[model samples]
Target: MFKIKKQISKLYMASILGNLSLTGAWVAILAARGYSLVEIGIAETVFHIFSLTFEIPSGVFADVFGRKQMLVVSSIMRVIGSICMICSKNLTMVCAAIACFAVSYNFSSGSGDALAYDSLKLVGEEARYERYAANQLILYRLCNGISTLCAGFALFVGYKIAYASDVLVTCIQIGVLLSLREIRLDHTGTDRKQEVLQSVWKELRVCFVESLRFLKKAKRAVFLMICNSFVGAVDIVLLFFLQAKLPQTGMPDSALGSSLFIMEMGGILGAKLILWCKNLRYRWVFAVTSVLVLCGVLIEHTGIAVLMTLGGFVAACSDDALQVRTDAILQEMFPSEQRATLISMESFTFSVIMIALSPLAGIVFSVW
Candidate 1:
């Protein structure tokens, strides 16, 4: 029982360490490096392409193997991705680095939550998963906000050092992960390499087919996933472009990080406050949050730095509020056997939306 509680704590720790990336202001860094908005958009598209491809497969691997192992793979990929970014000299090289980062994201996306949820299930504390998810969002937002606060420092030091710092932090995260015990409901104790491979393939196939069957019957889950993904994609694009747009409004270099940090606080607030809406219907919640996001978009386009930053804050807040609620609902809907794969499907939806929106948004924001 103590080990189970400690597992939850470690998951929180992992979330904090994972999001404390100094290169959180990558968009601004790229703009400073003379990359055009279109070029950056292409790079983002490359990332989602890789994400779209690997998202489900990675989740399947997590279910078949172990979530802990997949998370370790995520850290390794992050280190490699950081190294690639440090050595990158051109757009193509940047895209290569982005692809590695995408793979890193794919590996860890569903595995963490699935691990935490299943761990709780073992101790019959699964009802607490919503609170845990909310706290995870809060940690993610706060750490990411702090990282955004380092934009000035990252920009000043250049990408090489900025990404090298990330490499060092990720190495530490890997150490933390090594201490986590694998939480699997089933064990295949096969020693033969060929047999193990065959077993894995069989499990992957079963997981995928079962996930599809569940989705076919669960239409509401599908709708919730799509709606949440669309809103998230829009807010993310707005935030990404704002990293460059904020500076264009004549905001001083020193204040850039602070402004971004303020914007991210909206997410933290939203995550904390969403619990208030527990009694409200999901549709009503979605309606109100979607309107808030659109209003933020309108404010962001006003060409004023203060208003634009405020707009970002509002959008982030609303987006996260909706996200927490949506995630909790979806987690309840997903079966334990296919939890990671289904969560990956949610991420897959987001990647699809991002791929469609990123380049067009870049062009629109650049011209506007």
Candidate 2:
């Protein structure tokens, strides 16, 4: 594990806080709104729909139009969705809200990594990627816990309050982006494009072609992406499992909030701890992911909210470490220019698979 440069560490905090504020209120808000288990599943479906629909184009835009540009646009979309949530509670309103939020989310997903990577490249310190990875994980954890704590207080007052807070957070993130130097991480800027948003067929062809072209160019990168995706999928399993079992405990809100907060706290600790790790002889991520899924199974088959919470902690620790290691490996393997495209391709594929399976996974957990 390496140390993140001071500048990267500072901006990372803002990014983490912005993300946590968005995610923290979301699950609790939907649950409080009387969305049934199935309806919640459908909402998740809508989220993925937004992801699936936007992933490739957003990736291209992040590459070509500039990450900061996409990020600012994403911030505005998030603020709009938060406002929608504040004003309405009807099914149509909720669906509209999900659509808006999902677009913001999908739009911003890989762009953050793209921006961070570019910043490192421009500073001629791309070798320090592992440090950035670890710091990012820790900040994400710290913000998650804080957001949930904030959410509990907000919800005690009202869920709308929590949504409004998210709006404020996004506004702050926009300012943070403006503070950073413009980054063209890759030597050749990715933003050159000749036409309007391409047709679905054109987009599909570009995503696959660009992905495959990069794959042939960097074999080691393909391996890292495969490993990252496999490990990341296990996370989806645990997430949907929570969607099922939290409702079963009859203390759904508190259970989800407490467990999520604890789990994220573990992530904060684990990420910091990674900087202290002295060796790379361990496959810790695989170990932790296995435990997380096992805990999900046990929590579902038995009445073990305590174990579920513990599982969340274990899962978080593993994921944080896994991501740092993956970044270190991939950064070393890929040329700077293609790194963003490859990562976006991997994420787009992962989201596609998760969307197809997440609903079925939720349904199975609910029945069992």
Candidate 3:
């Protein structure tokens, strides 16, 4: 029980480090380094491409190998990526950095939640999964808020410093991760190598088949996943270009951090509010919040900083709400045996959507 608590703490801390990037200043910094809006979009495309390629394989590997070890590898990859992002001055370097970032993200995608859920199950606390997931989301957004709040000041000092902070945080996350124990629910009592190998193969095959079966039969789950993925794509695109868009809205570059901080705060609040919204239908929550997101994006160029910031806040809040609700639905829909793989499918779909839309987003932003 104590160990489970410790793992939960480490997961929360690592989640904070993971989400806490340079916030709104990354685009500005990249632009200052001579990257056009299109170039920035291409870099992001590179990210999703790598993610789309490795996302499911990594998840399968986690279910077969071990989640804790994969998480360690993820931290190492993120550290390398952050270093690259900090040192890079050109598009090629940024693409390399984003590639590493994508690998890191793909590796860790569904593993964390799977680990947490399995840990709770081992301790007879499986019922706490939704609450735990929600709390994790809140903590993740809280870190985003902290990162954004400091990003402008970091930029005031130097872009290198802002980017370097991500490296430092990831390093700390690695240290926390090292303390986590691997929880294998399907641990075999026998130490026979051949039998273990066969068992792993069988589990992998079952995981794949079950995932497909779920997709074919679960229409509600598919629809929810589509809505979640769409909102996620829009949120990510807006976040990537928002720093660039601020200038067009008559906002100074220096205000980027504060603007991002406001959005993060909204996300944090929305995540926290999900506790009260458990009774609400997921579709209704999605429909209402998605409309707000659409409106926010439509009016993003209204040339009012306050209005733009408010729109950003609304969009961020909606994304968080949709994410938390959709995740809960997925958790309930998938069996524990196929949890990681199914969640990874959702992530893979989102990545593919993002990859397809990235270049178009770049073109739109560049033309605008």
Weakest lDDT window of 10 consecutive positions for candidate 1: 186-195
lDDT of 2 by residue, 99-130 (tens): 78878876677777766776676656676667
* Candidate maximizing lDDT: 1
Overall lDDT per candidate, in order of appearance:
0.89, 0.66, 0.78
Question: Which residue ranges in model 1 land beyond 4 Å of their true spot?
Answer: 186-198
Compute each candidate's TM-score over C-alphas. Answer: 0.96, 0.83, 0.91
Ranking by TM-score: 1, 3, 2
Model 2, stretches more than 4 Å misplaced?
A: 1-10, 20-25, 185-211, 217-220, 240-244, 247-256, 273-288
Q: What would the per-residue lDDT of candidate 1 be over residues 1-368, giving only the tens digit for each residue?
A: 23887898888888888889889989999999999999999999999999999999999888887889999999999999999999999999999999999999999999999989878877778789888888988888888789889999998888899999999999889888888877665322211121255566787999999999999999999999999999999999999999988999998767999999998999989988888768989899899889999899899889999899999999999999999999899988888778899999999999999999999989999999
Which sequence of candidate numbers ranks them by lDDT, best first? 1, 3, 2
| TM-score, prediction 2 | 0.83
Worst 10 residues of 2 by lDDT: 186-195
